[model samples]
Every structure is written in structure tokens, then in C-alpha cells.
Target chain A: MVEGKKYRQFRVNKHLKRLMAKHYALGRYQRYWGRPLHRKLAWITSGAPVELLRAFKIYSVYPEQYGAICSTAKATEKLCQAAEAAGYSQDLCSYARSHIGSILRPDLAPMQGLPKPDLLVACNNICGTVLKWYEALAHLLKVPLLVLDTPYLPGELTEHAHQYVLEQLQNMVRQLENLTGRKLDMQDLKRQMARSAEMTKFWREIRELAQAHPSPLNGPDLFIQMAPIVAVRGSQEGIDYYRKLKAETEERVRRGEGAILEEKTRLVWDNIAIWPKLFNFTKMFTERGACFVTDTYSGGWAAELASGDPLESLAATYTNIFLNRSPEFRARQMIELVEAYEADGFVMHSNRSCKPYSLVQEVIRRRVMEKTGVPGLMVEADMADPRAYAEESVRTRVEAFLETLQAL
Target chain B: MEDFFVGVDIGSLTAKVVLVDAQGQALAWAVDRSGYSGRDVAQRLTQEILEEKGIKVEQIKVTVATGYGRVTYPAEREVSEITCQAKGIAHFFPGARTVIDIGGQDSKVIKVLPGGKVIDFAMNDKCAAGTGRFLEVMAGALEVSLEEVGALAVKAEEHKAISSFCTVFAESEVISHVSAGALKPDILAGVCDSVAARVSALVERVGLEPDVVFTGGVAKNAGVAKALSEQIGYPLLIPENPQITAALGAALLAWGMG
Candidate 1:
């Protein structure tokens, strides 16, 4: 049988599929894996070890978590420059740069000369760029790649799209069998999907704990805990990792250990973090006892949304995200999270490199505030391109805005 | 008995209205700063352009709106700027297959199929790396108005090209060069060269098989357009009102539908 253009459909999900490694990372962190530290900071390097842990059914780490790691570490220049020199220009994406760096310089690898991937898995939901990036790497490393197809259903996934995703999930099992040289029992895939469903439900509980008068965990802490969830999601390891992270979060809530900052004002952040300035920005908030209760970066959920019906859930999780939607949809999403978390303000990052995400931010912010009476502050910066961020400019704007929000 | 079809591009910074007669020749057009009220602006501009040409709005077969602000006014159809530019170039120069549009906020490189369908394209909307907005800043610092930026560049035979790819750095770099007594035209040429280098990368990405059509507000600058054409090794066909190319394409789309 000849594979045609339709087979190319399966490759679209390669981005999210490779991100299953984040679930693997989550499994590691949840169980406390090899104690890998990238920048010698407990939170920064905790993500890489979580990747290994999930393989042992320990934890899962979010890929974005690693993106955050590279952002704050500020050492991704060589790999990004190489990618540009190789013909991928600034128009691509920063996430593409980090992956290129990961492949070319094992020295830049989070593991730092540690073992490379035993397998490569991907999903198409994050963005189209990731699919091509992983494909390039898969060709370079000569590894069997497993892809989970999710249609580009921006607002919501239709029933047809959901069913189609399930069929793709089943087909992936066959691909896995061909590469691993072992037949995947159908019962195993369904069971793994069920475990993921359970874990996503548990993860939501941990986030809702933030709804408690004061957030049980701060933005930085949630940023840390997100590791296990990303490392091993959709597997027993991912399920187990979130189970532990959930437990830790709940225990904190039970003991009334509110997220470090306690204040009257709360804000929801949209777009990517300005890493070079996160320390300065975090201080701006932490010092004032203000909490960034939720952000679009921290918003994507493996919630009940992706539960019981693995295909429906995967489609639900991928298609209905900040990146996939028009500006109107994005505004609704930010507004919903702010209202759910009962946030007082919104700080939107007008990212320089991501036009699709950043273009309508001003309109979204204005419309959201008009409808909901929630104040919104806008900041300009780049997600991964350091050249786009101006530290002094952003600092002055953010500090003044925070002060005004406080006064309100 | 000549009828006209119009394209109105409501851009982020400007609103442009272009009218094409039955033969595809653009008869007249108007470019204005986009105001807060787009619907009002579109209505008023349509009257102004048609009256200016002594033509009535009723004589127009179809009207289309395009641009970032195109979304604001609900039009006959909201065709994408990508599609509009490809079509606008195809309509203007029958042999034109490539278009380099450097707008106020973002820049785009488009490739047109024979029928004006966009076969492949690339854009640099996320940064100021290669956009007219960057030059607008450079023009400000050099004390040589934006209007003379392109013309002045044509005269500079021995000017140092600014090395700063960043808009912020380029501003300061231009300042230092001027203080050192560099000719305004030379600095302008250097800036035009910088924009050309960046635009060329995107054009190459789309596999630039000419004839090329340089259309945008920036294309009005003879020096910059000349610089871009030289860099690409082809003479560019500059439409009469390049700024409304996107909106013109949008109007053409509406005419096709009706």
C-alpha cells in the first residue's frame, strides 16, 4: 500500500506527541528522579530529571516548562544561530530554536551529556512549527517517531474531528509496534488513556486549590510543578506523577499554606514570559505580595476535557487553546480564567515574534475589560527573541501599572 | 460606459481606497490616516474618492475591504491581505509573480499563481526587523524627513551601512554617524540597504521568480524601491497607489463574488 498525502495528516500532531516527554518529566519530578539540575537552581533543572522519572512511572514535565528553563537560562544563542544559518530564520519560532539546540549540541541538552531520547513522540496541537522541527530532528537522529493527530479546531472540536483523532491514536499504537518491535495490546492503549483521564482530573483539582482565598501555590511554584504533568501525560507514569503533585498541592491547601504572596489584587497573564526580566518582574509582584493567579502559558489543561474518551479529550485539549483561536476566542479564554480565579487585573504580554498570538492582544484586552470590569495592563516584549525585549522600558511600565492596579 | 470596482484597505495605521475601471487600470485612489471610527472613515472616504473623480458610488460594481482594520468594518467579504496582494500584483503587471509588501507595522513577501492565487508566501509580522516602521524611526533621527528618505539614498556613493539589525540600536547608530558628519543621503541609503537585505531573505524564501511587483506605502520611496530592485537583480513594477494594494485586492475579490 502506497502512503499518500492523507498519511501526511498523521504527521501534524508530531508537536504534541513529542511533548509526551513532558509527561515523562512530570513523572520524574513527582517521584523525585535523578536530581538533575541545569542551572543549579532547584526549580530550573527539576524539569529534566522529571523526564527520566516519568519513564520509570515517576513523573511528567511540560515541554513549555523546558522552554521556560531555556528562557531564564539565556544560553540558547549558539543553537538558535546555527538554525538560522541553516536557513530557518527569525520568522520560525523560539521553541524551534531550543529543539535545534537540543539536537545539535548535546552539551546544551538539559541532561548535559546524559542519555538521549529512547523514543520521539509528537502532537500537532501546539503549533505547525513544532511538527516540522521534530521531523527534521527525527531524520537526523534516525529514530522512530510516533504522532498523535489533532485537527485544527480552533474554537471547539467537532464530533467528527474527535472520532478521527481516536482512530489516529489507535493507528499510532501500530506505528509504535512497528518501531518497538512489539505488538501493542489494544487494551493497554485504552487503559493508558484512562489513567491519563484520571490524572488530568487530579491536576485540575490542584489548580482549583488556587481558587481558595489565597492561592495554595504561587505562579513560580505552579511553574515548577507543571514539569511532571508534561513529562508523562497519557501514561501510567504521567498519571502517577500528577497524582503526587496533586497530593502535595492539596496538602499545602489543607495546611492553609497560601502561595507566598498574599494581596488584595490578582492578575492573569497572557502570552510568553519575558525570561530575561522574569526575576525583576517576579520581584515587582512578590515584593508587593501580588500573585499572577493564572496565565495562558499555565492555562492549557489535560483536564476532564481530555478525560475518558482519549480521542475526544486530545482533540478537546489541543484545538481549544490560546494559540489556535482568533482574538475573540483568546479574550474569552483570558476572561474566563480571570473570572474563575477571581483575579482583579490582567497583564498581557504583546510578544514580538508571535504575531498570531500577539496581534489582537490590545483589542482583546480592551474588550475583556469593557465586558468584565477587570482592569488590564499591556506590556510589550518577545517570547524567545531576547532582541525584542527592552528591560528598562518594560520595568518602568509594569511597575507603574502594578501601582495603579493596587491603588484601584 | 466604464464601471469601476474599488478596494478599501483599512490598515492599522492608514485607510486606503483604490478604484479600478473595467479594463483593470486603476483610475484613482485615496490614502488617509486611519481614524478611531473605521465605519465612518470608510463611508466618508468612498464619497470623497468617487466625487473627486466625478463618479458616483452607485456606478461601482463591487467594493472590498482589506487589512488588519479590515476586520472592523463588516464588508462584502473579508479577503486576506495575502490573497489581495497576490491578486493586486497579478492585475497590475500581467507578468508579475512576486510581491514584497513592507507595511507600517509588518512586512510580507507574496508569490502569485497565474490566476492571482497565493501559491506560497512568508511574512515578518512579529518584529520590526524589516518593516517601514523601522525606517520611519530612522528617518526621524537623521533629521531628513520620511518623504526624502528614498530620494536622498539614490545620491550616496560612499556611505557606511548601519550594522544594527535592531530598530533600537539602528536609531542610536544613525545618530552617531550623523554626528560624525556623514551625509544624510548616505545614511538614508544605508538604511534602505538594511531593509533590502532583510526583505530579500523573505523574497528568497518564497522562491523569487520574477517579474517582481514592489507594492506598499514604502514602495513610494524611489530610492528604497530602487535599492530593493537592485538587490533582487530585477526592475520592480510599482503600482500607482501601492499602499491600497491589499484593499484593491479585497475589492477585486468582492467583484469576483458578485
Candidate 2:
């Protein structure tokens, strides 16, 4: 009934809500269910190797996702202020700040601040901030902290980086095992990796389905649907979820249906989503008949797991994360998305809370423009903090960018 | 019935309205302070423009609203200030390849291709450092009118550097310079140069294109324009009345292609 909502809703939205509700409810009442099931709940980063933790029978919860939920619930400003009051700088990642704030002040947090973690796991494959965030959490919660340090790949993953990550992953196995009082199950690990690989493949296929004319999925859809994959990847539930979502997407593509009624312009989105303004932002594009055919953020989870030994493969997969790579790699990835999706243009979110992602964006924008010859529009905002979102400014840039594509 | 098109740009500081015929020629234009009631001001301006041109409401075929308060104002359609500025600049200067628009609240550098198309753009983040608002605050700090600050800066014999580009911090820096008995003209010059430097960085990101057209209210400030031109190393071609560029572009869009 909104004025700017010209796009069709995905039928799976109800299913997604149900699934995410169940996932969050599981985390909410983990103290009740987890103890009896002999499962340890570990609060992990989005990019952490959760499959390994899952292999150790640890139920993983992503604080970053919860930070988003907190943001969507309009609790980020208050939560971030709480973190800032606790000596955390405002310049830190908003997700980390808000999560830490929730940890410190659970009364003001969503879901009473993600059930107390039995252990904490962090992987620096996403960003360097996670290690420090998890470190602070480990110190606060007095829980064992396991860290996977994936070295940044300025270029190709060298033998040294691969070995370094593999060693840490192996070390992680021991740490997780020690914390859970369980031995490493090789068969279970292999099965989990297989499921993870399958789920990633399905996700990739679902994204590729956007290559179809009038894209089956828009930017928000990709961002929202990617939740289960990030939180519960390598599980049967995740695999089944993606399988269903991908099938419906394929059906949409087959039926020649697009996320928006008339996909006049197709675009590629970069950086993490503006969680608080996802729907409103999506409408800005969709209402103008612009559909984001693909994005580099959600696609980070859709990367194919490298082949070979489980630890070695994860080392390659996680270390070679698009964010951990060079700006050259990022630009190429963006250009490839633009080309693959046949995008008319691209929009880069110059997120304020994310330095690693936002800092090199201008360079990436220039490179993408030179290579793809498609215009790249950079709009400034934050990923989680609604306070940083200037609705008028963002709308101006997006509308202009869409008009540029229309002119072309 | 005579067909007309209307474009209203309700910017943070000012609201602009442009009326054009079906052929995209500007017939009447108006600019007024936006104040707190942008929607009311925009409506008043639209009525004024229509009456001044002796045109009835029914004669307006399309209305496109733009700028920061564009959403608040009801119109037949809405467009972003970026596209409007690009279109307006292209209408005046067909060879325009780049546009630098510094409004009251935000500053933007747009890379424009041939035929009024914006290929790329980079805007200042949620900061008021390199915008008209920055200059206004600085002007107030210097106890001079915003209009006089520009001409006064042009008469400076010495230029001092303002280290902080942040509006709040820079205000303190300006006060400190004043306390140190720095010449008012020099301080004003430094402020203009600082804004120019900050905006030039954004211009470099989108790339510096020849025949760069500067639009928005800040373009009227001769000192800022001179400093900006020097920073980018390309002379800026400002419109006759730079503030109405976006509004004009919106009106042109409402007029549609010939």
C-alpha cells in the first residue's frame, strides 16, 4: 500500500520469516534446549568458519546478523550509545559497537542480547575488526576464544598464506573440541563441508538465476535470503532452505518474472546492505523500474569451497574472501558481476561504519567504470546505523543514477 | 490548452521552481528561502510561477520535484537533484562533461556524458564541511554577509590554511585564527580554499572532465568558484543563476524529449 512500492513480494518471505524466527527463538531459549542436547552455543562472526564449529556440535549464532536485527528493530542508536559510553569509540564498526553494547546492557538489547555464548569464535576473513570484537567479548563473557586468522591476499593466495590458515583451522578444531569436550569427528566434518559446499553452490546458482532477463531476485532479496546461509550453512536445514529458495527463483526466471514489475534498468550493488533502510532503499530503485540483479556482499557467502583437504579447502575459501583480497580483486569481482548480470550501472554504498569496505570504494568505482564502461554511483551511508542514513541524499543519488541508466 | 511543465527543487536552504514550455525552454523561474516549511514554500512558489506566467494549473502537463525536500512536496513525479543538475547543465552547455554542484547541505561531483547523461557521481558524506552551509557558518563567524565573504576573500594579500575541514572544528579553527589577529580576508580566503580543496578531491574521484559546469548556490560565490577552478585546474562555467539548475532540469524532464 506504500506509494513507492511497485515491486512484487517474494512468496518465500513468509517462509523466510518463519525460518528466521525459529532460528532466533532457538538462540533465545538456547539455555533451555542447548543444555539438554549437549550442544554448546558459540557466538560467531558472519565470515567465521561456522561449518567447523557446527562439526564440533556447537550451535553457532552470528552477532553481526543479530546486530542487524537490532538495527531493524531501531535499537542501534541506543545500543551504539551504550557501547560508546563503555569506552568504545564511535568509529568502530557499528555492528561490533552495538553488539558490545548489547552485551554490556542486555536490558536494552534485542532478544536479551543473543543468548550468552558458551564459547566465542572469530575469523578475520571478513574484516580485521572481528578479531578485536570477539576478543572483547571473550574477555567480557569469560569464555574461551578461538580465532582463525586468514591473511589478506594482496594477490593470489600463496602457499604460505594457505598453510597459515590451514594451521589455524586445525588449531581451531582442537580449541573447539577442548571447549565442547568432544573429539574431532572427521566424518562429520567431511559431511558438514559437503553440505556447506552444496549450500554455497545452490546460493550461487540462485544468484546466477538473476542473469535471466528482468532478474528473479533484487538486492534486498539476496541480502535477506542470505541470512540462513550465513547463520546455518553446512546444515541440512540451510541446504533445504536454499534448495527451496533457488527452485522458486528458477521458477520465476522460467516464467519471465522479475522482482520489479518492469525491470527498466538492472544494477549491481556493492558493500554490505543498509539493514535499517533495506526495504525503503530497495523501493527507491524498484519503483523506478530498477532491479539490482546481483550484489558482491551476499555473493561472498556463495563462493565455491576450494577442493582438497577440508582444512586446506577452508583456508583457501576463507582466506581468499573477496574482502580480504586486493582492491584490484574487488574491482574485478564488481566488473564481473556487472558483466555477468548485464547490469546497466552499479551503486556502491560508502558505508561510514565499515572502513575496509568503504575506504577503497572510490578506487574500485573508477576501476569498475574503466573496465565495464558502466556508470558507478557511490552513495554514503552506514550498514547498520540508521543515524548515518541520509534518506534525501541517498534518494537523490539513486534517482539520478537510475535516470542516467534510463538515458543510456 | 497551452501545455506547460513544472519543476520544483526544495533544497535544504532554498526552494526553486522552474516553468517551461513543451519545447523545454525556461518560461519562468523563482527561488526563495526553504525555511522549515519546504512543502508550503514549494507549493506557494509553484502557484506564484504559474500566476506570473499567466498559466492555469490544468495547463501544466507534468511536474517533477527534486532536492532534499522533494519527497515532502506533492508533485506529478519526483527526481533527484543530481540528475536534474546534469540535465540543466547539459541544456545550457551541450559540451558539459562534468558538473560540480555544492548546495546548502551537500556537495556533489557528477561525471556527465554527452546528451545530458550522468555517468558517475560522488557526494560528500553526512558532513557539512565542503558545502554552502559550511561557508555560511564561516561567514557568520567572520561577522560578514555570505555574499560579502566571497568578494572580501578575493582581496586577501596573504592566505592562511584552515587545517580542519569539519564545519564544527573549522569554526573553532577560524575563531583561533581571529584570536591570533589573522586578517579577516585571509581567513575567509583560507576557508574558501579549504572548501575548494575538499570538493576537488571528490571531483578527482569522478574524474576531472573539461567543460566542467558548476551549479548550485555556492557556484555564485566568486571566491569559492575561483578557488575550486584553481584546485581542479579547470575553469568552471557557472550558470547565470546557478541555484535553479536542478529545478530547471526537473522542469525539462517534465517537458520530456521533443
Candidate 3:
């Protein structure tokens, strides 16, 4: 206790309890760090791949996820130092820098008996930083490496990409055979993809189910749906999982279930999940009985677009959807998702680390409002880098946003 | 028996390890998803290979680490990615003076001076538009895996380049191409042309040389590497574990570590 300071420790905690409730993290902080799977070491991580790892029960670490973990508990500075020592420029990806630093210095990125990954996996879908970042790591580890490839299709994926991609898929299938020493049965693979497609359809239908006077789906459940969607997207398990989800949702609608309290507003949310703190985001609305009618994840079901045409469908998959299209297409898709789901407002996550996606999000937001008259909120945060996420500021913004929506 | 050395490159997407004798002769290599424990991953993989070859870890002269995990490696010293790449490339193709290394996390164009010193370099570590990870994610958008981008790109009938450097914009463009009824192979070829064009532009930024060697993980892609080679008017000298060039350079640096 400072003798002359009546308020040294009393700083900032006052206003934080006030308006921060609206954007206050509504999710519980569950510890995911524990015993890992019986597996090889090494982790190739992008922001979204963290969820994939969780689904596969893979014991890997994502530096951004670690940043999220660190920020929630306040340990980013030390990690930052370690990265600096590794000769990694401080200006690079903060998450990557922190992770690299941790790798360069063990005390910072400490884990239990850190084991190396047998393989590394990365998809350039999020950003290009990962490839070179991984390139360096692959060399240091000297482990068999694998990379998931995507061609840049800024305006639209050409029809040629379908065949191009299919051929690549065949190659990947072979690569997997070499890696896992487990054969991917054609029947099983097809069944998995079909199931995933089916689940996507069911989830899409459930998103539609929210069109009633009171939506059948709530924010809480809306967030949980991402699991099957992400974990089993190209496999049958996702489809089977979504089937059960759709059935239960149908029953919930039949029984007059409202996910949130009073079920008054229909909101459309566009952006990636703050997985490190998802429950908080959902709780902010669901406790209010606000049904989140639509999201990009709901529209991730282009598998049916190529239904029965796996090879061709796979090739054509990325080119046919708004999610994979230009910002104009995405703008239009957001407009449509709002209309189809009859959302009353829009919540757009302006994630910082993901500048590419968030770049035109404002344009999309304006277009959506002009096209649909639904107000949108541009909630900013790091896709996964905790340093970029301003929880207090976002909470304040959301609270005001909901107030305005309620006034409407 | 001569001393042996090991190099490991741990990236955001993949982990790779390479083994070499004192002469820098490539022995064994592995690539895997790095869960954690990159050091153990490196040590164990090296051990497994050595054991298989009836050798021991101590029998090896030195170990070096590079990529995103170089310094933290359980080794004597860590070298800059640029330095390691120069060494790795020089070892593979003695005549090489320039190198283009595209990995999941970053893309680098290096000007290798005589004696494996990096004279100058340019790198794109921010966006995926021109890096390997871009192709990885686009694979999903294109409905393929990371490994298949090259072959698919080779099938393009029309060379329509995907012009967007931004992945989001590219997504929109890819969808439009698909809906417009363009042939899948043609579209894929366009993307390949686009990626190669971006890479070529980067390479040109640092000034290209007569003999350019493409290192890093992407060099293994027969399609894209070949496309890159054609675009640059030179043959790409890719090592068996092309991704490990940076780490091998670091491992080779072990010779200087003491």
C-alpha cells in the first residue's frame, strides 16, 4: 500500500465494470492444455487450424492461440522478448514472432516435455506469412512436411481450378497414405464427405429455422455448430453430426424453444470466431434471447452445390460460393444471408490480424445496410493474436450497438 | 566414419528435418505437422534415422536449427534464415547464384554471393497472396489439398492469372471463374500463372541472376516450380528436402558455431 496513494490500485477497475458489460467477454475460460494424444510432435498452425487441431485431438500449439491464452492471463511481454532474441523482426506477425521467440527460447513458450510434430500442416487460406514461417521450421525440425495448396483466385476461381484441385486432392490422398500408413478407403472417404455435405445442409436449414416469429436457434448453439462445420467439413462425420443437429433443432422449433430471452431481434453475424473466448460473445446476445439467424459458417455448405459430382464438385467448390469469392460477392452474400435469415441487424467482426477479409468488410457492411436497411456493427479484434484484441473497447461498442438496435 | 549434421525447419504449417554428412550430402528427410516439441521432433527423427543407419547422435558432428524455430532448437547455434538458405542452396547446386524460397509462412528471394553469403534478399511475410500457405487455403477454396496445387496448375489450358494478391478478393474471383463456366484446369492454370507471376515479380525486385535456384517447401511442387522456372527463364534447382535449405544452412553453420 502506497502511503500517499488513496487510489493507486483502484485505477481503471471502476469504468471497466460499467459499460464493458455489452462487449464483456461472455465465454468461460476452459483450460485445453492437458494430456495430448498419443502422437508425434510438431504443429503447423494458422488461426483457424487451431479448431481443426482440437477436433482431431491433435496436441499442437498455435502461437496466436497462445497469445490469446497469454492475454487473458497477462504474459505477452516475456514471450515478446524471446522472439526478439531469435532475430525475428519485431514488426512481423506478433503471434509468429512470439511463437518463434518461444521456440528460440524455451522459458517463454514452455510446455510439458515439448515433443516435436511428426508432420506440419498449413493452408495459405488465411495469410502467406505461414508458408515461409513454416519453411524455416520445417528445416529446423527436419520432419516430413506437408502443405495444403490454394491458388490465388481474387475475383473468381476459374473452372479449371476444379480439375486442378481434384488432381491435387489425389496427390494429397497419396501423401496421407504415406504419412499415416493408414489407407483412406474410397467408400469411407466418400461417405465422410457426403456426410459432411449433409450436415452442412442440415445446419443451413437450421439457420433458416430461425425465420419463425421466434428463431429455433440461439447464439449459444450457433457458436457450437462451428465444431462439426470445421472439424468434419470434408468428411462424412460432419454430415452425420449436422443431421442430428438439424433434427434436434427441428424438434426445438416444434416445441417453441427460443435460444435467447424474449427472442425479439434477428441478427446476422459475419466474421471469424474468437475461439479463445467464444462463449462470452454468444452470451452477450443469447442471454438476451436474441437468435443469431445467420453466419458465414452456416453458408459453408457448398458441398451440396457439387452433390454427386465429387471430383468436379471439388474442383468447382471454391469458385461457386460467396465465401470464396470477391468482396463484392461476399457483400452480396452477407446481404442475402441477412434477408434469407430475416436478420434485424448485422454484427461484423473486424479482426485485425486478418486484414484481407476485414479490408472490405466496411464496404460490405455499408452495402448490406443500403441493400437491406439493417445496421451493422464492426467489432474489431485479432483473428487470434490477443495483442490486437481490445476486449474493453469492443464490449463498450457492442453495448451501445445493442442499445441502438433495441431503440429501433 | 565422418561426422554428421542435422537441420530442422519448423514453420507455422509444417515441420521438416534433414540429415547430412560432413560433406553436406543429404541422407534422410521428413516433413510433418508440428504439434509442439520441435526439438524432440528434430532429435527423435534424427535419432530414428541414425539408429536405422546404425549410428548414434554423438557420432554426428553438429546440429543446426532454422526456420521459425532455429535458436530454440536443441543445438549449438541458430543462423538467420537468409544465411542458412544460401548455404543450403549452394550445397545443392554449386552454380546457383540466386534462390527463391516460398514457404507457408513467408516467401524470400535471395541473391547468393559467391561462397554462400546472402548479398541481398526480398521477402513477403505478411499476406498469403504469393506464399505457399495462400495455395494451401486456396486449395480448400479450390477443393484440393496443399500437395496437389502444382499438378492441377499444370492442367490449365488457358493461362488466366488470378490477379488478386489478397486472398479474400481472390476468393470472390475464384467463385466468379467457377460460375462463369471456365474449365477447371484452365482456371487452375490461371492461378498457377498468377502465383508464378507474383513470385517472379518478387524475384525481379531483388534482381534475378542467370542461375536461380528455388528452395523452400514450394520448390517441390513440380507444377508451380516448373511454372516459376519457365516464367524466370531458368531451371529451378530443388533439393530432395527443398524445404530444409534454411535449416541445413543453420546446421552447416554449426561448423562455425564452435
Candidate 4:
């Protein structure tokens, strides 16, 4: 079947669909073979330390990704209502609220909801909301919860912060050992970290391929493709997938093929993808030949993993995740993206779902515009919930921002 | 042969059309409630204005569409109201460094550059609290006309405060204030002050500049203009026909295209 002309199809989309299908299938039927294979299925946050869990032969499931899937399935409003009925505040993170709703009523959820987890792991490096979210999950599922708290870094990494994160990681190892009944193998962990680092590097390189004129990739492509790196990091399958993507992307760049037919203006995107309307909303830019070459959202997975002892390296790497940093750090990162990609302008998604990413965006927007002399636009919407999206308002702001670039 | 340029602005509550000649002089313009169909209103008004001026459609060199319903119009080109407002204000006041536009559904604060381009801008979130709609709703609740609210508000010697920034909540608050024996003009003054406070927050986001140009339907309200000036610490320069500025900006852009 042919796709619509409104969007240019990516060559590797079929492979991604197959990979995600197989991954979800494995999780859906995990109860049948998981116990025999001695692999415990665990629910985890997107920013949690997955390598440590992988070393114990644990299968990881990302509730955040599943929440996005539910949104794409157009089941978020119903699922969120279920959660709200159960006393969860509507003001809470939509991902968490929806996931909680799915948990309370799996019959109304997609795929009859995710398989029941044997345990839960959460890291506060992403946002403080995860701590409370995972705590609720742990209580409901009656599973042990492992939390690795990464203190917010105002500026440079202090010695106390390093010791604090490393100490918690060391304590987490004992809990994992007790749960899995496996000893911590230093060699096995080293191998996992190495694979994880290589996979992250591959992603970083794939993003750089977009630096080519008429970028080989667009925003939706990046948002969709970065899933495996988050879901199955520290695994050979994830690395292999990225390797093929890198090679394909490089080929596209070499041939001067772009994600869109013509790239008249290059833009940088901030915040998370509007999952429910990803294709529809992105067409607003691609149809105008304004391609989003890079984004801060998916780039969160491409941060280089530090090299050192396994626990200490994980501490340094995960603690400094972009979402946990100060606004100055984010501003500098955005300015660098504008300069590095030769971006004509940038747009900030004032996402209502994620406050840590959305708040202080105006300040950052001003700083980037002042530094780059490129106009910045703010579009208010939610990452997963379609209800928050105001189509006409977003269209006006984006159309205006694009016109500003054309005038330039 | 006469060369004509046209600009059409289709907002949430109203639709406006402006026609200009090759030399950029206004030929004819019209404003009416946008009603249910922005596309229909824009098409009909453009036709009426052209016919009223004895001009043929073929004489139009270019047409630019703007405002909330901009994309729905089949003009030669479409632009953002921010850019259109900046261009429109700059055409009249060459020194306009800031623009505060309070339309029916949304409010915008734009920082204008030297060439009539928008350097940066901030807009109200998905709410009607800080916009012209808030005032219109308050006027209805007070049993006063939209035009009378502003004029009557200026008569209040001591203005009371309306604490809520939400339109629905503020409506109820206004009702209770009236029941509590608060003067009608004082409550109206408070409503204007509330809009000014909300708009001030948006303006602060973009950073204020001197020679601020205030345009849009709300600019005709002396109460709002006065309160906004007090909050911004500078008197606003409202255009003679503030409601048609965005449409004029679109016409100016159309002329530039020609």
C-alpha cells in the first residue's frame, strides 16, 4: 500500500515497525516463557539505569513508551479518566496518570495493558514526578521498588553529588542481587556499559547526519526511531539496529536526499513529541519545506555514557541527564544546536504534561533569540494527550514563525 | 490599469478586509462579525469592498491572509498575525519597537525590529481570561454595552479589584460584587485592570520596548488602554482604526509582494 503524499516516507520505517512489534510481542507473552528462561520482566522509567538491570538478565518495559502508544491508539482520554476516577489528580503527569488508569482497568487499555511486572525501577534524573509515580506503582503491584536518586546539578558536578549518586548505585546492586539471586559480575557489567556507550554514540552520529543540507531525517523520524535505544539499551539488538540506521542515514546524506523534498528552512525543536498528532502536526512544517533537523527531546538518549567503574560511570552519566540540568545548561545546549545545525530558527513546545521541560522555556527562548538572532516560537500542547492541543492557535504561531524565517 | 493589493484578517470574533493601491494608499476597508464561517465572511467582504470601490478582482496584484482563520483563506499567501501586526504598526509608526495586540480570543506581545519584523513575541495560553472576550463577557454580565463599559469605567473614582483571571470565574465574581453593592463602574474598572495585569505578564516575557504600538479591537477601550499604559509604564500609541491594523498589515505585505 502507498502512503499519503502529505509526508515523505522514511526507507527504514518498515524495519522499525517490525522491531517494535517483535519487542511488544515478546513482552505480551513473557508470562509463558519468561519464568522458564529465568528472565524477570520489570517495569522501568525512560531515564532509569537500564544497564544495571540488564546485567541480571531482566527484561525492561518502559511505561512512558507504552503511554505514548496508548495516546497514538487514541485511548488516553478514556484511560486518564479512569485514573482520575481512582483519585489521581488530573494535574499529574499525563503519562503517569494514563499508565495508572491502564493499570486499574486493563480491559479498556491497549494490548490488555502491559504484562504485570515482577519489580519496578525508577530514577529521579528525569524529574521528581517519577519518584512518586513509581512509588504508587510499587504499592499497587506489590513489588519491590529500586530508586536511584540523582541530585539536580545547578552547574558543575560537585564531589558530594558524585559520591551521593555512586553510593545509591552501590546500594542498588545489593537489592538487584537479592531479587535476581545472581552475583554482580564485573565483566558482564563492563560489557553491557560498552554496548550501551556504542549504541548512544551511534545515535549521536545518526543525528549528526541531519547536519547535511536537506536533512536525511526529520523530527518524527528521530522521535520514533529513538525508542529502541531507550527500551533495549545495553543489548546487541539495539546496537545492531542503530548501526543499520546510521549506514542508511549516511547513504541518504551522501545522495543528497532529504526527509522532505526541499529544505528551505532548518528548525530545532524543543520538548517532547505530541504523540497523538505527531504526523499531522509535523506535516505543518514539512509541507512548508521547513524541516526540523534536530530536537532536544530525542537527543536526551544520545548523551555519551561516561567511562570508568560500572556503578561510578552510571552515576556520572545518568545524573547529568539534560532534563535534570539548570535552564542555563539547556539554553547553551539550544544555542549550540542552532549554531551546529545552521538552524534558521527554533520552536519551543510549552508542553503541559512535562513541567521540568516546559517551565522556564520563555527565559531560554529569549536567551537563544538574543544569542542567535533567530526567531523562536512557543506552541502550547501536551506530549501525549491530544486534548490540550489547540490546532488553530498552534497553526498561527508556527505559520508566523516560518514567515519570519522567510522574510529573513 | 490600476494595480491593487488586498489584505484579509479573519479573527475569532470578527473578519476585516483592507484594499490598497499601488502607492499604498487605503482605497476601502470593511469590518464585520466573523460569525460561523471565516472563509465565507472573508470572501464576501473582499468582494464587497472591491465593488464598493469600483475595482475589479483582476486588478489585484496580490492578496495576503492573516489572523486565527488565516490558513482557511485561499489567498496568494498567508502570514502570522504577529508579523502582520508588526508590519501594520511599523507602516504607520516607523519607531514602533513594541506591539501589544489584544484581540478577541488571544493576546500577543511582540518586540519589533528596525525593518518591521518581529524579533520576538509572547502570547497568552489557551485561555480567554486576558483577551477582549473576557471584557465582552463582563460587559454582558453588567448589563452594559461593550463600548459603554470602557467609558463608564473611566468615571469610577476608586476602582475595586477583580481577583480571578479566569473569564468564567471572573463573571461570577463580578455578579457577586454587584450584589455586594459595588458600583458598576468600579467593577468595570477592576475588570480592565485585571486584563492589564494579565497582558503585562505576557509583555514582560518578551521584554518591553519604548514607543509601544497598541492595536486590535480592544484598543478602542479607554479603560483598557489606560490600565495597560499604567501597567506598562508608557502610554500606548493606538492607530486611528485599530481594529483593521492586522488586515492593513496583510495588505501591506501583499503590496510588498507585488
Chain B superposition TM-score per model: 0.89, 0.97, 0.88, 0.98
Q: Against the true structure, whose TM-score is highest?
A: 4
> Candidates sorted by lDDT, descending order?
4, 2, 1, 3
lDDT of 3: 0.62
What proportion of the real contacts between chains A and B does each prediction keep? 0.00, 0.89, 0.00, 0.93
Q: How big is the positional error of residue A321 in model 4, measured in Å on the Cα after superposition? A: 0.8
* Better structure of 1 and 2 per TM-score: 2
Each candidate's interface RMSD (Å, one decimal) is: 16.3, 1.2, 20.0, 1.1
Residue A59, candidate 4: how far off, in angstroms?
1.0
Measured by DockQ, the strongest candidate is 4
User: How does each model score on lDDT?
Assistant: 0.65, 0.88, 0.62, 0.90
Candidate 4 displacement at residue B91 in angstroms: 1.6
Candidate 4 TM-score versus the reference:
0.97
Model 3 Cα lDDT, one tens digit per residue, A235-294: 444455556666766776797755554676788877665544566666666544455776
In candidate 3 the C-alpha lDDT for residue B71 amounts to: 44
- Rank by TM-score (best first): 4, 2, 1, 3
- The top-ranked prediction according to lDDT is 4
lDDT of 4 by residue, A267-328 (tens): 99999999989988998998888999999999999999876789889999999999999999
> Cα deviation of A114 in candidate 4 (Å)?
0.8
TM-score per prediction, in order, is: 0.54, 0.94, 0.47, 0.97
Number of clashes recorded per candidate: 45, 0, 125, 0
Tens digits of lDDT, candidate 2, B113-139: 787877788888778989999999999
What would the per-residue lDDT of candidate 3 be over residues B168-231, giving only the tens digit for each residue?
8887787788888876667766766667888898787557896788877777776678678889
